[model samples]
Target: MTNSNHQWKKTALSVVLTASLLGTASMPSAMAASAAPEAAVTTDALKAASVGQASGTIAGTPLLQSYALTDKLQVEIKSLLNETTSEGTRIAAVVRVRSSDANVAKIPDLELRVKTADGYEYPMQASVFNAHAIRPGTTEELNFLVKVDRRSPSELTELVWYAVDWYSYPKKETVQLAVPVKGQEWTGPLSSFANSASSVLPWERSFTLSPALESPLVYTPVSVNRDNTPQGPVTTVKMRVENPSATKEAVPDFTIDGRSNGNGSTDKTVFPGKRVEASPLVLEPKEQRYIHFAIPTDKDTVLTNFNVLTPETFRQLDPKGQPSQVSYNVGRYQVALPVTSRTAEFNAAKPYEPGQPFVFDSLSDTIDPHLSVSMVEFHRHENEGEGYQTVIAKLLLTNNSDLPVPVPTFQTKLITAQGMTYSGNRQTGAIAEIMPQTSYAVSYAFNMPTENEDEQYVLKFTDAKTAAPASTTIGAYRVAMQETKLDVANMSFYPFKVKLNDWTLNARYNVPSALSPNTPISYTYRMKLDMDIARNEHVVVDPNSSKMQLELVDKTGRILSTKSLPFSGVNRLISGPQFIQFDTLRTEEHEYPLDINIYEVITTPTGEAKRLVGVLKQ
Candidate 1:
């Protein structure tokens, strides 16, 4: 599976694409079009040896304009590569899309960007026509890759694409039939592991086979570390058997397959085993072991060879001794090594100052046996626009384990004391299930570093491996940006005063209403609860804690009517003036629009409990 549907599974920064295949064609009105559909030109003897140019636009419209493809499919853009290598400057492009529609057509969810007149935009790490379901009149071909670093090639230029103005091709009970599997082949000698400070390259590979009577069978390999663990970026490997010889044998347990080295060809089978005892492989004489086979490795996977079957190498490559077994032309041997993330290291270990906590009781089975992370707050906020700056943290997670703990998937970074590692921009809260000893409060808003030099600013929690990180410095000074305005007026009722515990709390608001038709509004409010400082701090005002809301819209703000009001006191002691009245109903010529909201939850003589909000407007 060259990129077996590209296998994306990190789950938080998003970028997953590889799904195309499902056919049935017939809608050719000359390939219909009114505009936005140009970029199929490559004939001047094939565009004079082309090197670039495929035009784009899909929500800015223009590809030539005109748009109508609800299942007669027919998209264009054919070629465009910007190649520059050495470790950067690679941008490939090709978009086909062909269907005729007679009952099979689909291509929803689309996005691709590549602009460059020197404005730089490049987005599309993966997702767009990877072939899994696009079969109607047949003509799939959607590939796009981006790398950029050797200085963006030369300002590159043009190749945009986007879809969803009403996308089409999804009906056969909502389509889902791609069926294309066949990828797992091998030749020999191949073992790659990327390096040069891009870190993560811890490898190990061994071999020795001799089936058919079963005598020799070494095969070592262990390196497991699902990257930052969460089962993402995967790297597995596992398989350590031996038995160099001396009788007592049965063998039989190999199975492993992978493929991807150019032009994507996904063969499947990425670590699926069960022969250590689910039967077979008896070994006992010199018995040496470790099986339960595994192989994973999918984030930019590049195999091209990794087939390792058994049953006496499928009965000595059969020709006559066929005891039967046709698992795909039967497998035998092919394990050239090429799994990626060069092994795996997940760096991060030098820069501790805000209360040290980058711990990981070392994953006691997976994420420290389920929950207990830490890092209780880290501030720094200012300069939120134009150049950027804002940290704000608070990640406490605590589930103590009892089932209901699943919060593994993180990737935060801010480092920089000259080590540089910025990268924190999509953390809109996600825990998906916590409940056990209970405690879940995750709130991070990172975005600081402005091109370096604020000195320390660490704040890294890479993947909270199992919680142990508490502070990352970042407290040099900067947290001034509080704008909370709300003081409306047109006088129907308005008043504001906040000074709790030291006295003074007179809040009033009864405004918001203008566009009558369903009319009948009445409001009365007043409050005075003071024990002068103590009469046992007098308390008595919980008419459901006083809260009122009424809405009746029709000026297009939707909302026919809503009402609320209830104040029930249970007492602690109190003496004063409290009058709350509420009645609503407005309807005159049906102009609608009449809203009012008021809340008051008080109790302060030193008992603390407050909730106030009412800024009248009409």
Candidate 2:
């Protein structure tokens, strides 16, 4: 948005015109002989406007330069670092502005251009800023990141700065700084250039959305996934929007456009289908919601940038108490996608054991007395014949603050040692709020290939806070199970003491219409289990929680059928026969191993944590 008024625009224009005329009169004889007449004039004009230009090369400490735009505003180039990578060169500039006592200073729409030795200037491919404005009588850092085509730092002679004037007409006042580049080439990972305070600028493995909104709505990009189909490559971008205001706000109607490359030839309106939420949705005060946008792109397309446009219009009362139409332009916001898609290189929380608590502090500043999360249990149900397994991760979250804390919807992934990643689906227990100093249990389920069950795996969690999205990891565990004979007694399963008293197996024959009564076409097998469970007080227990499961597995370890038994908090005995039936019998053999799994709900200072004590094979 344009920040300056007409008066400031006039003053900036006059300053540039005066400086050009003075520079032309004093043009040097050597520069004029070496360059064309037009080129010489333009170069001299830029040099004259360049105030407080820094000298020497960018080797040790970065050189600082200051530019005075008006009597009230001055911009300081505090530091600069050029990072070279195989794909491109990134320039990080730490900028600060000092405002006069009389007026507040808004950061000008700035552009940085790299000037080559041959006098060619290349505009930055992408850029991001840390802040938008500066307060009066105060100086604040407004750092930014700019990326350009691959070029040796020594090949660049100077940098050109443009302060765009967008009030009435579009124009730019230019300043040229002579920053020589000389030193060993600094080669490192691109994410290293990201500011620790705000990881959104340079782009990190996981980053929060940049604060580019002009309204009260805060939007955060949660995750992006690409799926290949016969039609094309479909990319789904999930975003979380929150309205932390006193008044309800209409969700902005934003359209996302994507470009495959910098040339913009492949630019397309990517998100054609409407969002999952209803159109013209209005968020209640302090309400948060998640929205998904499905973008179908051309085959073999990799979106490098996303342009979001939100055009909002509303009616307001004028001074005369009459309604007037007003246009609120939130303008366009750009997001630069990372060069590569990989798991997060760093974990915000440490790798915790299965039952240990993970105290996450990264969000402490955003949410007072941040909550802690712990892995209570991990369950893997194998359906070998179907070629897939259903894995569930149960977690306990405790709110340590005195006030109630709303549970954040988490995006989860299960990563194996061999680098295979599976996205989790069907999350439960995130709808309710966690009371202060109490724990709440939640579970995430993932359907993965049965072949991956033997591989070591880890669980990753990402919170959906727009301001500070954080990721944590737990595990590197192989499924632990034990085999036992039928009618085993006095078995320990963490918080539960179990005794399998007895079991019965029966088979029923089914006759086909064409076959005789003696000739059975199919067989139905049923197995009944009688067990006793004693619950301990080590963990908080829920009466209606499904705490145990029985699975009948074939000789090949494929589960043929399964049944779940809900824990009856009133009695320790599960006396009635619990039967599991398999309808189809391919062979005459009827014997199969039964696996019994027990679960426990425990209470701690944190939220309720549930545990899958252990699996019993009989």
The best candidate by TM-score is 2
Off by over 4 Å in 2: 1-258, 262-300, 305-336, 341-350, 359-370, 399-408, 417-419, 427-438, 463-544, 550-564, 569-618
Pairs in clash, predicted candidate 2: 398-607, 439-606, 439-607, 439-608, 440-607, 440-608, 539-602, 539-603, 540-602, 540-603
lDDT string for model 1 (223-293, tens) is: 32233234534333345566657777666555654434643244333433223235566767666654533
Lowest lDDT sum, 10 consecutive residues, model 2, at 56-65
Model 2, 81-110: lDDT tens digits are: 455666776554444566775666666556
TM-scores across all candidates?
A: 0.20, 0.42
What is candidate 1's local distance difference test score?
0.38
Q: What's the lDDT for residue 522 in model 1? A: 36
The per-model lDDT (C-alpha) reads 0.38, 0.50
